[model samples]
Each structure stands twice: as C-alpha cells, then as structure tokens.
Target: MPPVLVKGALHFMLVYARDGHVEILKYDLRCSCLSLVDVPLVGPGIHGAAILMAMEDRSLGFAHVDGLTLHIWSREMDFNRVASWSHRTIIDLRNLLPIQNTDERLRLIGSVEGSDTVFVTTDLGIYEINVKSQRWKEIWKSEKFRALIPYMSFYNPQ
Candidate 1:
C-alpha cells in the first residue's frame, strides 16, 4: 500500500487489492520496466475501496468509494500509446459531508502527496477533500475508523 509517485516516465505506482478487485503496477525508470496497468472495473460489491492519484495532466488517477459515491478515474493515452480508464468525476458524499445519517462507514484515507487532496473518514470526522475542487473541511475528529497518513508542506519564514 505504498508506491505511488508517477509523474513522468513512471517512477512508481503499485496498488493491488483483490476481492475489491484492483490491480495497477507501473514502474519504468528508463526501460527498467515493471508493467500492468489497465484498471477499470469495480462494480459488483466494491470491496476494498480505492486510491491512486497523480493527475493534473500527468495522467493516471483513480479514486473509488462506492456508498456515499465518489468515483473518479482517469488514465488516458491514445494515438498508439494505448492506455485507458476514463470516467472522470462523480462525487456525492451527500453533497460534501455534514451527513447526518448513521451506520458509519466511509473510508478513503489517502492521497495528497503532489496534490489532488483526498482524505476521508467518517464516523463524523476527518475530512479534507479537494479531488479537483469539490472542496471540504473538518480536518479531524474521530470516533472509530482510523488510517490517515497524508502530509503536505510549504513554509517560508523570511
């Protein structure tokens, strides 16, 4: 669950979760390849949720959470390069959180390295989602679910 850096020429990308069905692996530091990336299948019961992001034109991006509905995928390249998986955005976290239902369960808890900003966990807390500006807040307040490790930095004291 650790290997997702892909910017240009693919230096890292590895996410393999079965039962929820997902498999993506790409690492090619100038021909030292390690392929297998054609991910686009998650419908039948959507098991382990999903996460793998690095988009902003750098291609390769997929984030899936089916319940409160958040499914965004993008990995496109044609003209012979051949690489597909395009179904871009569909977020409906009850129209962006403040959800007051019950039965708790909504976990994505990853992303925000180079930024697409995603970290969601709701027993009623921990939410900082931007996934292309659908904006969000409430950055911490747990009760049950836990697994969040996303760090961002920018400081200048002059």
Candidate 2:
C-alpha cells in the first residue's frame, strides 16, 4: 500500500466485501477516475456453512476458507500435491477455489508428477490457485479446471 501512486498519475483500489462483492476505486486527480465492475455473485455459497463455486467457474470442488489443510493438483502432469512441505503455515491462512481432489476422494490423494500448475476440479468445474506466483495473468486452462486468477493481493507499503 506504500504509494503505488506515481507523482501525478492515478492510483487504483480494489475492494472485496464479505458477500463476494467488489469495487474498483480509481483516483487520478485528473479524469473521471471512477468506474464500477459489478461482479454478480459469481461463486457458489452454501447457506451458513461456507461458499462454493458456481458452475460458471468450472469448479470441481471448493474448500471454504474456514480451516487449515490444503490440496494442490496438476492435471496435465497428472501429478497432485496432497500435502506440501514448503508452504509452511501461510497455506493454512484461508482458501477460495481449491486445487486438489483428495478431500472429495475422501481417501486422501497423493501428489502428481511434472506439473507446474496445480488445482482442483468439481462437477461445477476446476479451480486452481498458484502457491508462489501472485501475478495475475491468464494461462491456458482446461475445462477440467478453471483457474482462479487473482487480480489483487495485500501489500504492506513495501
């Protein structure tokens, strides 16, 4: 959050609400600097328990961000990460679209091989989240799995 602002340029703010609502606020001290992108309640949310993904996102399975334990998967490589040792504790922070299938399998899945991207797939579709790359860019995704492209992340003015 530390002055991503250019001396006389514009600054952008992306706000996410509890209801999956988002507001993009822009300020340039120049033009209209205001625009709205109404992201209609896109994901699936089960009453009281947690939110799920809509069929639109092609999410196969979703692990509502209410607990720890993560699952990552890579289909092309046919390798899945049931448990990762490098992630440490941040992996426990919270989750959105899940990237593994061990939970759905209920028998605990193992890891895939040679796959760079890892994710999960539900009847709705597939949801994948990158563990290291925080950058937002579209990758060649499969109908088997829809990529959860992140447009914004928290920054500490660094």
Candidate 3:
C-alpha cells in the first residue's frame, strides 16, 4: 500500500493474512520516530487498507469483503493530539458497483495527491472514491491499467 503524510505524520498500513489483522505504523516527522497505531477490533476478512487525509484530518480506511457484500470502515485520528483512533462505518460498496459478483476483488490502492479522494481497484475496474462526499466514480476498467498505485508529489512554496 502507498503511504500518506498527514500533519507531518507518515502513515503506513500493514496487513497480515495469518489473523486477518490490519495495523497502521505511524511515523512522527517532528520526533523522527515510529509508533504502531492502536486499531480497533477489525476482525477477519480484511481485503485491503489505505490512509487518507481529508480537510487536514487523517483517516484510515479498510475494505472487508463478506460473501457478496463489501464493507468499508474509516477510522479518524483523535483530534486531541493523542495516539488514539475511532472507527466509523463509511460505506458498503456492494450495491455501488454495477456488477454484483462475489468473485470481484477490491483493494485500497492509494489516495489522490492533495485530495481526499481515494482510488479503489477491483477485478472488474478501478474506481475513485471521495472520502468527504462518500461518492464513487469509475475512472477506468481493469484492462486499462495493470497497476493502480498512485504517485504523490509534495511541493513547498516557502
């Protein structure tokens, strides 16, 4: 998964198939150190995960597939400047897509640079999801691109 920088904090998602656990590694740029983020009980069936920033707030999103339903959960970082996370049910993509097939694989590829929109790739196609509006738009089909990894660039005017 691609890493995201939010408020000078570098975030990386680590997914393990052994227990189907998804954890985040946060590296504080100011302190120049790394710390593991305490994630809530995500349970099993985690397909993919990614970190996104919306309105200056960092959020962790995970995709869980159960049968024919695709569940997405977003966890926002606590505003109290503490090392805590709160989970929120963002959306269920099962009905959003045109095709309704259990064989479709969904993964959180990466987020758009300088935007809250995140890209999710499925076996059928690639979709762009807006974190704030909770809207989805299919950018391209799976045949258009073999990979969905997004490239982000940082520019400092100062």
Full-model lDDT for every candidate = 0.71, 0.29, 0.60
Better of 2 and 3 by lDDT: 3
Order of the predicted models by lDDT, top scorer first:
1, 3, 2
Give the per-residue lDDT digits (tens) of candidate 3, residues 1-158: 56667667787767776786877788899999998875554666553433343332445544444444434455554578554444444566666666545476656666665555666666677888775677888888773443366666769998
TM-score versus the correct structure, for each prediction: 0.31, 0.21, 0.67
RMSD of 1: 13.3
Give the higher-TM-score candidate: 2 or 3. 3
RMSD per model, one decimal? 13.3, 17.2, 3.9
TM-score computed on alpha carbons, candidate 2: 0.21
Best by TM-score: 3
Lowest summed lDDT over 10 consecutive residues: which window, candidate 3? 47-56
Tens digits of lDDT, candidate 2, 41-138: 23433211121221121211122232233433211112563322121112432234433442442111111112122333333344444434522222
Error of 3 at 116 (Å): 3.0
Regions of candidate 1 where Cα sits further than 4 Å from its true position: 4-26, 33-50, 53-60, 64-71, 82-87, 95-98, 101-107, 110-120, 124-158
Note the clash tally of each candidate.
0, 18, 0
